[model samples]
Target: MTLQTNDSAPHPNQFALLKQRRFAPFFWTQFSGAANDNLFKFSFTVMVTYQLSVSWLPPALAGLVIGALFILPFLLFSATSGQLTDKFPKTRMIRAVKNLEIAIMLVAAYGFFTTNLTVQIPVLLACVFLMGLHSTLFGPVKFAYLPQVLSDAELTGGNGMVEMGTFVAILLGNIVGGLLVTIPEVGHTAVAIGCVALALIGRWLAQAIPELAATDPQLKINWNPFTETWRNLQLAHGNLVVFRSLLGISWMWFFGAVFLSQFPSFAKEVLHGDEQVATLLLVLFSIGIGTGSLLCEVLSRRHVEIGLVPLGAIGMSVFAVDLYFASRGLPVVPVMGLGAFVAQSAHWRVMADLALLSLFAGLYSVPMYALIQLRSQPTHRARIIAANNILNALFMIGSSVIAGALLSSGFSIPQIFLFTGLANAVVAFYIFLLVPEYLLRFVAWLLSHCVYRFKVTGEQHIPISGPAILACNHVSFVDAVLLMAASPRPIVFLMDHRIFQVPVLGWLFRLAKAIPIAPRAEDPAAYDAAFAAAAKVLQDGDLLGIFPEGGITKDGTLQEFKGGIMKILERAPVPVIPMALTNLWGSYFSRIEQGGAMVRPFRRGMLNRVGLNVGTVVSAAEVQPALLRNRVEELLA
Candidate 1:
């Protein structure tokens, strides 16, 4: 069954989603659940670390144990939850998950009410595991549900809002949990009441979510988690890009989990601050994530721009390294309150580093999540996300263990931050090398948005998925790069062989896997090979781009279309989208009056306006050289 998008409003603001029933109820429901989870967990961790004493559970290990328990269910039950999510209506699953959260919180409230440390600790620990189970069940449903309801255009913005909301919810939960647990007399009671109240609120919000049919209603159940987990990993591995993205996201969790799990001890020992300082760090990190999440929609111009991924990685590493330097040599001071910590000039850099690092983390993650949802098959999308959750859990658990070992080895918290930061650079570089598409897109995005102002009209003509031919007028050498920036999905361009000989741009085209075509009369083998490669791209259900005019025009005028597009259409009967590039004639990449392109740099200056106008799709039968040229000319006019 085909899943349709629920994007009724044209050019709607991301915030407007909060007002619609299709999105709002689900958003708030998940928000409340995140808040409750952190509220209960942080409150318990703070109580154990600062308020209570236990030999079996030391203060140093409190955060790690709590975090490990919460993610444990993701490793064990995520596969089953994902299968169930696919087989059943999402609204039903959401309500059921919310109900489970309510029950778990009630149990936790009872535990919090107990006065005995031994009884209270064990009961609360059990609740943490149960809460993890709740999140595991909801994980697939939360992510998979978005692609069902949002259009491709809205996917990035929608995911951004959710990322921002989740972190903000985390921020509030941590703040409240940290503060309430430190209260003089009613601290425990306050935390208990808050957890139950948030759970109730989440349940109430879940009731308002509209009914959504299951993506794969007939999928058979898989009872064994180990077998199902392996099967789900196989499903994700089927798409290398998606599978790598799953690993990338999991790695991010690994990096973040270390810092998050160390916050209590870092605040107490390193910064010499009270519990409020720990809460303040969370608040800064959460606000940064929220800001960065919102910035993604603005930065990408409301597109699923994966180009931002590399940029985000760079910032995350840079800020993380700076954080190490910022906090490395702080003066030894007495434990301070939030105000005193903020007032200290020496501590400001540390705070900035945390916020900025988390901000970039937000930018790095939202696009990947949107990409996974957009690329994965609709039928088993939940399972793929479940695989992601499983990987995330494993990586986070590894993070806890490694961090614990590092601490045991006498490495200070600042040194761990430095190690993680440097490690991030190596991991990100390796991933980019494995997938050059990311770097290529980054370069294209940089040129399109920075070197030139690019805009696209009738972008809907570009298919979000499946095979199609993009026939555009080749105006300048950078035309393909601009098109890449405009497209949500990758396009395989069949360009003249000479363009592949150009300086830096040649390397970029090669990296983008563009097919280099030659004239059939001059080099038959190369021409045949290029055509064959183009055919394979379309055969594999990917977009094929062609410059039917064969080469860049000498003058600022349209050239006669060549017959290459016709041959491609004959090989693969896909729709040909007519497009035109306007106002790129006098640009730096275009030919000058002397008939040489790229003779002068910045001829048109920065932010020069360039536009791509997409005409209606022409069926394979109706696609001809002259017809396509006429269509392009019409769009150009």
Candidate 2:
């Protein structure tokens, strides 16, 4: 995981803090919340749709009510919750929420054990609404809590870990919920006991969490949830980038809702299987999501990079479509356990498809969540997160409507999956194109880490206008990521030919559209082409980044500045801004490292206090490689 400090620089061991009291308790609480919510809601959904079909109300109507019960809280209570989070101690508030969960579980238990559906039904609905309130209140506090407890370096890694935990909790919860309902005598009791136990444990954990004071303590409690929710929405709406990220995240929920809510029907019609098959699909998807979320840390080296979104979308489309083909002409199978299902010949395709779908879903989601956390302001972070949750709920409701319509319109379950996968691809393309910033950031990130360590300051010195050449000391490969993270504008980097040939790193660079240069003696044509591209990029009023040191530092010191940078500058006459990257000498990506290089970033709070120092912007006429090198060296020293 990418370990960072409060200063937005890397630190080691940020991951370990996840296990500490401050975070772990809240983690378990949230985990339990997701699990319990799914367990009761899914069990209730199953009961209404199948077991309770003979009831007075139509099954579809009953099912709709159940779904509405769960979602109503987000629409009604989230605003109140967000206000509470900002006004009180989050840990204490969380403790109360958990306790409230325990009470709700009692109501649920009484309903489950009783024969009175009339009395039980309304109680269950009330529980749902209260749970929503709990979630709403918890929303702002949950997200806002992180930046308070975690240093900046820990944000991405920490967010990734939280997301990983949540997905895992969800998978386990869904599987356990499904499984518990099957046992006649123990089923209801087991669920009730589980909810109570998990809630109590959650409460205990909340208590263990350290205190986090309100961001705006004197802020008046705005009891008018609707108006305040809109106001909070307006605050989030102010940051268009963050708003887009939120929408992207909301889209993921819509996709997930469609996939998850259809499992029973999918298992029955698509796989021609029983309830167990539906459970299996849930398990696979949940496991896949958990795996994918966790993998983001490994894939991103701890930064919240958006390229993973496209990668995830691609995986989703490929596997989902493949799954449809895999299921073609397959025979239906009866209900079976894991082993039986495995033995049942037709289940293989469904399982494979489910697994891949979940995996891709994970890849698509984790970064979006982390990006919100990373990009949102520390104070209003939770409310923004709450807004995300609210949007997610709304999108999910819409997904159900769309999926139901499709299913009713003669679309097979697998066909729906196929369409959704294709739609995912289209949506991904549209979102990326609409917001090129995500793509640009990915490019910057790729250049920073693949090339060398980057340091920036007086980044403001680089005119936020016109064209500029960012000249910096090349200490390691990842200089681009840091610079990109720091730079407000997209930069077209001029890099060496050899650096563009390494395996996975090479693909990332190519994807970023980096201009690779070879010496006149190495590849003269490629060299000429690279410079031409550099000039064009500058002419387009984009920032052009280059390292004057040529390549990685070989002697633990800066090399004599090369003149190719001077050539690029003379062609553009753009302002030249110098920067120094410090404390990244020992990072795994550092060229100074030998074999057995550990490329993964350390957990937050584990790494050294690394920083990027941005120097003054010099005029093109004043640009001197030696002078720039000396200035950068002085900063490093």
lDDT of each: 0.89, 0.73
Give the alpha carbon lDDT tens digit for every residue of 1-637 in model 2. Answer: 1111123334545457566776777777788787777777766666666565446657777767877777888887777787777777787788888888888888888877776778766776677777766666677677778778765445556666677677777777767777787677677778777777877777776777887777767768778878977987887888787888888888888888878888877767766666776777877887788778767766664545665777777788888788778877776555545566678656677688788777878878877776676667666776787788778888988898899899899898888888888888888778887766676565555445444444444444544446878888876666665677666445678888787777766665665677898888988898888888998888887788898888877645888999887778767777777888887766666654353334555622253455778777677889898888888888788
Per-residue lDDT tens digits for candidate 1, residues 1-637, read 1112223357677898999898999999999999999889989998998888899999978876887788889999999999999999999999999999989988999999998887999999999999999999999999999988887778888999999999999888887888899899999999999999999999999999999999999999989999999999999999999999998899889988888877877898889999789878978888888988888888887878988889888998999899889988788988999999999999999999999999999888998999899889999999999999999999988897888799899899999999999999999999887788778788888988888888888877777767888999988999998889888889999999999899999988998889999888999999999888998988888888999999998888899998888788778888888999999998889987865877677767789988999877788889889988999999999
Q: Report the Cα lDDT for residue 483, model 2.
A: 71
Off by over 4 Å in 1: 1-9, 408-410
Candidate 1 local distance difference test against the native: 0.89
TM-score of each: 0.95, 0.74
lDDT of 2 at 308: 71
| Model 2 global lDDT (CA atoms, 0 to 1) | 0.73
In candidate 2, what residue range of length 10 has the lowest lDDT sum? Answer: 1-10
RMSD, every candidate, angstroms = 2.3, 9.2
